[model samples]
Target chain A: MTLTPILAMRWWLPQDAALHGAALDREMYLALWIMTGLLATAHLVMLVGLCIGRREAKRSIWRLEVAPLLLLTILFGWMTIRAERLWAATRYAGADPAVMQVEVVGAQFVWYFRYPGADARFGKTKPELVQPGEGNPLGIDPGDEDGRDDRVSSELVLPIGREVDLRIRSLDVIHGFSVPEMRVKQNAIPGQVFHIHFTPVHEGRYAVLCTQVCGLGHYRMQAAVRVVSIAEFARWSER
Target chain B: MKIFSTHHRTIGIGYLLLAGTSVAIGTLLSLLMRVHRVWPDLNWPLWGVIKPEDYLAAVTMHGTLMVFFVLTTAPQSGFSNLVLPEQIGSRTMALPWLNAAGLWTTVASLLVLLSAFFVRGGGPISGWTSYPPLSALAEAGPGQATGMDLWLVSIGLFCIASTMNGANTLVTVIRCRCKGMTWGRMPLTVWAWLTAALLTVIVFSVLFAAALMLLCDWHAGTSFFVPAGGVINGVVDTQHGDGSPLLWLHLFWFFGHPEVYIAILPGMGMTSMLLANFCRRGIPAYRWMITTTLLIGLLGLSVWGHHMFVAGLNPWAGTVFQLTTIAIAIPSTAKVLNWLMTLWGSRPTYSTPMLWSLGFVSLFIAGGVTGPVLAQPALDAYLHNTFFVVAHFHLVMAMAGVFSIFAGLTYWFPLIAGRRLD
Candidate 1:
């Protein structure tokens, strides 16, 4: 069996499947072009020096080196400014109040997602009330009035083109909530809650992966993310 | 008695041997992981099926060994011990006994770390970072039991050894330079070693303190890292509360980011020295290269927050880290340009050392470019903990350091052995 195909694999990134993925791809390509240009120039200079330059013709061309350094510094600064804007748009910008909010709690080997019911509020949770399989995987207080209609599902269902605010949590260990296609990842820390927002650009099924090595079953910790139409999402939520 | 004497050269050779052994073992572990990745279900007669726990253990060991033993040991201790004194025209280190003690301590630490595999739980799967709650609670996984304890002990010991080694190197460079061997005339490799030693002194101390705190949480019921309300396997751990795992992340990366520079700076030094020597000319911007090395080291400290961007750090703090991280590219780019300029307008020798130096430059550039992308908090949110990260770091830190080590070994083989391998 030849390993050529595996060794010759050229693609380094997974497909862009999120609404903002195109921006990331563009930034990546821009970085690639800059890097390639710099690398080629450096190698070409070395090649010319080795081939044609006389050994005794050593001269300190400080300006030649400084020129590129200045250019690179300006480019890097501009890129950073642009990146800060993109980052702010994703992280610092407040999530839209009208969008859907989902609570995702990661465990040793599973992902549990909770959708606020028609009330649009999450129920109170206490660590003492957590029981994995006895109808309280996320430990929602049974007595809390707001939790009565909360829909807990093993799978994550999001509506296409609609923004999602995910408040990620963990029950035990640190687990990473990663969806390669959606270009989203955040660590689910046991004692902390992390919020990330993204909109699904395409309608399809994607895998929710645990990127952190949580435990023995870390590799198998996954759930299906189904992006459906708004009507279908509403129907699923009602059920 | 004389044969066992604590000479700097002997100590250096010992460190190299230990580092070489670590590289061998670490490579074997990585190969095992690769095999498991390609053929997950393959069962061998002796090793049996690769269990998930086993895979994690192998990964943990591979990273720990490579980072601590091979990268840290070979470049700073292994190379510096033999060459630093000679470069400065000193016959011995400022404190020869401390050098030997550091080497022996490192050896003992390696033994303790390897003994984790023999423990009942069979090595910690927490990876090299050993993030808490998972690493703190024994009930979290099989490896978190006795194995993690041994891992911590081993690391604590190694940190102590590295501290001693760094002090010795720093003092030697400062006070022991021979007459007329000014700092300006000293080789870039010597400067690299000095810078690496300085970083080791500062960073390893923090790591040691963190390890002690982690150990305290494990044994003394301290909640330095184990946050409150941690439940593992349906059992609520009631011992510790109010501890934030982010504290561990902050502390670890504070040392960890500089630790990457500690690994690569020496390689950069070696590449610069080799390029200048093989080209038989001065590097175009010699002072700038040294200044940039210092700048990169200083900037490395502030950029550690980039690692925590996806770990739920405040967005504003992430932005600060992103800016600092992007700024680091300036010094790094200057170094690359200087290296190319060193090669320009000279009789380029295609020797093995020169070849490896060229490879290092190319690989470092390729790896350095991806860094800015990850420096962006938005992009890092997606790339963190993925193969993309693994690829970036492996290119920058792992492969680049390995190439420089090869270059150094090849360049110095003849001087040490009186016969060149080639």
Candidate 2:
């Protein structure tokens, strides 16, 4: 039996479904345990001191102050290095060149996903041509040959086991694109394209939430991300 | 007219009362948001079926008021005015007129902020961080047009007021100390106010400039924060030229992170003073305590990028900020250790103020332990903008500030009101 569900019962974090998520969860748990132990010890010391009233003051400043502080410095220094390395594993390193590419666009209150069709390249988009009512929400330019085969969908469909590189941006304001199950969160800023890569290890559907408060519809701003078998994803993309 | 009196004590009481009212309204707004969040369909007589924009407006106003009017003012402007001069053996602040001016400007800023709700689109939904082009463009959202302008203007006025207050604190602490009250001999509370004032003088001015830049972007068609954006609300943003949203993040967080120190340092000082007094012993290693206080203030200004780690900040820059944030934890840890050491092995009085100090210590530790966790960019990747960040700040900054405020009120009630409340 896996310990993840049992851990989830008490950790209160969402189920980890991404490959990088387990390490992230491990780092988080380690930090939490260290902090919890320190917190309890500090409180216990305070309680003991308060109860043990009027004892002669010990002149050992080094024992009392310097040693503890030095220990904390070293401990936290180690944790910081570990956490930064883990974070850099995704952000500082580039994804494989052969990985799948998807353009994720965030509007006022919606999330739109686009796939580079047969051309395997995204079509150029213009802000002016964006009219969701006109059946073109991402504003695919008509003149660009790469634009013709681009497929736009409200939901994101991914093939399991493939590393997907997401080029995320917003049409208006700043919106946070967060999928908790994937342990992915990045701001979709206007005039900026942030590329984040992650691999899915599970085939279940997950909720894509807008973490940044966008507008009146922000609460309901969500989409579905369905991870499917490679064969199923191939058939779906072709359609 | 009485509220306009220039007496530092009266002005201090005015600040305390103002913060009291603000905390009331701010707490009510938060409660409304919380209830609405849990029961999205829950309807109240005053605010029926809270919309997302309404919820967001509450968020913006709640943060602005709690951070500025309550946390910033109560500890430094309110409690310090009541006790700072007395503790440092000064008859009055170095610049009384400036203190009075700061108070009046703050009052005006509060009025203007409240006026945003009555305007066309209600309060701006952008959070107190107020990252633009959401805060810059007029047609970005329901409250982006007129409401945001008022928000900027109000914040500008607050920046000016805080700058004035900081100046007065610095001048009083530096110049007005009575004879024989040397720097080392000065109370920790005075040192806290001095360092916090120094931070305020520097950072609030930067925030003022940032607010002005955003205002220009809004009406003057300047592209300070709004980039050559392709579109907002289906309208091509042609009026604005090249600008980066990251510029706003840099300027804002530059002020924003230090603003946290500005709010909490005075509380930390008060905790030190109270713990020593109630514990029937002086705080051990007073010099180190002062050094940590100043170190926290100094290091706070360098760690703003930690707020932007996942906001597209370069990975290398994020690592630098991560290191600085962890460095800050060293001083914070030493400070906590100092508090615990002071309380050790002494017959402590459990008076109301003592309880408040102890409570502040508890909250501070609970809130602070999470600092290193969130400071790491890896953890922040998933935790930034989440409720975890919210709880961290609330525990460490906001609620702890409130606790310190109460500690001051209980301890200094006789000084302010000529009678103890408890």
Candidate 3:
């Protein structure tokens, strides 16, 4: 079966609103690329050093050994300090005070998403009430008043240019929640609620695949993500 | 003690040879998976390419062998089995028979591990954690039947070997210091090994306990990790509802986290000593370096919660575990700086061993930088399971740890075999 395309046409690789977040990804990638280049360069220098500095009858292998060591230390220290700054900016940027909070529950194979109702509150849905096949025991709980206006869907949707807060959890086993375009991923563990904040700058669709092997259906545990224009999202939600 | 005894040197050489073999095998397995990802159309007559069942088995073998066979044993047991006693000036390893037992048992474990391939079902797919329900039942994956049973047994045997080797190291270090080598004068490598062995005492005991419990669930009928009402594959799991699966997690990580250090702390100590010696200067902050080594070991225990932060653990638990995990960086960073400073303003020796040591520091810094980031309760909520995690772990767990072990082997080849190996 031919699946839909994943890489969408874009002016930039990571088209996201959080400017710091976008920059962090590019910087880190470039830093690693440079590191790799420098490493190969050093290896070449070592080869030359071996030829010149070896205990050969014609050569001394010991010229300037200390200098290279110092250079390596400099490279290492610079990378560490640079990495520290990026790590802080990419992962810990403040979350917007106003954003949609969605609770995502992943069990054995499928993912369930619950939207806070008009009350902006998630009603209780007991694990026992969950049953497979017959509307899913993990389905929405209509008993609670707040469950009435809340929307439930297997697909995840976020408004472009708006921050979205994901409260991720797994009802059974471990499942990884990942958005390739966003470069965001976190493990959904039982009894754990992981949170992530990201603002989509491009209006496009992406796939969320489970990176962790939770079970047999793990390979097929795929979710479609729709990053819609703000008006389009509002129109869809209003429906 | 004897200016590099022939026997000690030979033992060191043996470690290099064995570790090399495991690395070769494990690396091949990894490449198989990577290539398979690129070429799913693989077909090898009798051995079909990349079946779902095969992926699980390979994953199981990859993790099992790498973690126990290569990563755990190579550095701590294989190296310490040969080096620590010598480094401490002991004439022979403590309980020499037990020492041999460690090797044989490890061999036996590898045999049993590899034997899973020929078994009816293949190997268990339930990640290395092998949580119950999936791990407790014999029908979870292709090899869930007899193969999983052997997997448990192999691991059990491996744990026994580790305990023996750990005991030997602890005893030799305590009882056999060479003349004038006080605890103060002991090489940092010796300190790291002793500290790692002490940590292993807890690590092996818990894994052994968990293994025995798993055996009981798989064979004799117990529900250590399964839920009673849960039916796996249409058949109700035997005696399920009564077991507390999380107990295994608690016990496993208790040893698992320290086991992480058991893999790295030695490299840290080795790096420290090598840099100091190669630089032809005394290691600055000798007291602080030793203190930090000990602290890295002690603080490692408190950070297990970092693994469970998102497991619906108390939010407050997140704060505590994060603090404990991040606290480790203070001393760890100190060690990194110490290495950099040791080489400052001095002529240094450049050899294959030195190359590996420098690489270790680089990778350690690269990976260790992210440890604190992932430790943040809030931040880990995002970066915990991505390729980012994969990168960090690969850097430290295999790259730094395995590379340093490689360095040790190359550096000490003359001592072991009397001929330098490039």
Candidate 4:
């Protein structure tokens, strides 16, 4: 069990593409190290006990046993406190108003993304008006004034170095919207909207996948997430 | 009275055999899933290429059979029926007829669940959790028709049977102990079984209610779990409206999380019992071990929301669930520390049971350490519904529970069979 080869298995995690990826990877590495140390120490103690201890019945005392457990509790408490802070910061912290906003609606076998146009507001959508492939995949109300300039696309194109807040929903069944590289995942539940925010620090095309078992075409339910430069995003959104 | 002549032991043995068969079949299904993962295009005899529907069916059957039939049946019902009374110096369970009825009912449920594979359109594709409206609408997928209905009925039957066994075990433990067998004098195995039975009764009732509600949504046209204005398979679901899908997730995981403990607590107790026996010493912190078990049981109920963190739960609720879920690690860690300390100053005899016990501890620790990572809603958002969560649970719950079952069977083989396994 050499350390080099195991740590070298970097393919286990997708490449870091989001601003928070480095922080998450660092925490993951730290947790793994702590777990490995604890595992090794426990096994080592067991080995020594087997090799050197007597078979005679010794009255077990609480004082000696409780010491290690108390230490473990302290360590666990410290880790939990640290991890909780990180979680609260990521999950509960309010999103930046300057960040880009995208609405993602997932159906049985496809992902549909909507971007607010120059008005910076999205038009209302009615479930009754939802008719897929009839020029209204997301059921954007035709009569709504703000919806005329709303750009609906199948691909999610984000501007790099800027935070993006995704409001996720499902038109039908439950689906999971996941981008492995960005370390972002949130369920697209029907009748409810889930908010997930991440900033792509790198410019790359990543595969956006549905992690949930949606249906028979679950394996093929995917979309492309292209993080482009600001200029390129401006040009693309204009088109 | 002849022990084997009584219906208690016979029913116990029957449950064990059925559980064994279920495990065997479940393992094969899991193997199919593994094979399909690596070689997606591979075709097999009779089944041909493993289509997505087939894969979903295998996944569904594998989880249902292993969780309900094998894990729940073998450790709690099977072993407790045979050994709990004997450990308490009693001849048989308090209600032998009820025990027999429970066993037979479980067998019937297993049959009904397996029958879905042969039905038209094959077995249910909704996975074991059976989240709706995929599970609610027959037109949602291929197997959502007859197979989903049978799946619900089977689960309902299992819940009833498990509740009966839980009641019987609780009654027998309370009343059938020998005159001198005080609570303190009882073995750890008995304590584990008692706690597990308590959980089974409480949790399975909720599960049964959920199953019934789901059945109503399926057949009786009730809108309990199915939301209105939803479309499945390109058709609008007109029968149901204004229902909440999240309602089902809340109810299901409420029972589901405790069900994890029900599957593992007995194994924990059995491991404690074996550690003491093999090391030729009592657990170092015996009172703490019992206290930890109780704490784990109580804390287990509060942590069910962890499963819903990524399922669109409120962020504040997710934080609360995360805290409770992390609290479980405290008691769980105490149990592990106590086990290690029990073996600290004594030589451990490496019998088959002892080996299994050691393996259980090692595997459990590996599994337990991963809990805190997943307990974080921030982290679970990344890991949920991935193979990472799957591996985490398989290591902690399934593998750990199975190891304890193996340990118990090997330890009690001589007493049960009147001859040593070797």
Q: What proportion of true contacts does candidate 3 retain? A: 0.06
State the TM-score, rounded to 2 decimals, of chain A in model 1: 0.91
Off by over 4 Å in 2: A1-11
Per-residue lDDT of model 3, residues B1-422, tens digit only: 33223343344444455566767777887888888887888885788767876776777788777777787777776677666766778787766667766776877888898888898877777767676555666655567778888988998998898888788788888888879879998888888888898888767888999999979877677767654444334333435456655666677777778888998998898888887777666777777778888998899777787776545455566666766775676777667756755554444678788888878877787777667556655445445555667787788898999778878877766666668785
What TM-score would candidate 1 get against the native?
0.96
Better of 1 and 2 by lDDT: 2
lDDT by residue (A138-165, candidate 2, tens digit) is: 8899999998999999999999988999
lDDT of each: 0.87, 0.90, 0.70, 0.86
Candidate 1: Cα lDDT at A53 = 59
Give the clash count for model 4.
1
**What C-alpha lDDT, on a 0 to 100 scale, does residue B404 get in candidate 4?**
91
lDDT of 3 at B276: 72
TM-score, every prediction: 0.96, 0.97, 0.77, 0.96
Per-model chain A TM = 0.91, 0.94, 0.81, 0.91
Candidate 2: Cα lDDT at A119? 82
- At residue B293, candidate 2 shows an lDDT of 97
Q: Write the per-residue lDDT of candidate 1 for residues A143-223, one digit (tens) a residue.
A: 999998887899999999998999999988889999988888889998889888889989899999998889889889999
Q: Residue A57 CA error for candidate 4 (Å)?
A: 7.8
In model 2, what lDDT does residue B197 have?
A: 96
Candidate 2 docking DockQ? 0.72
Rank the models by lDDT, top first. 2, 1, 4, 3
Ranking by TM-score: 2, 1, 4, 3
Model 4 C-alpha lDDT versus the unseen true structure: 0.86
Runs in model 1 with CA error above 4 Å? A1-15, B1-3
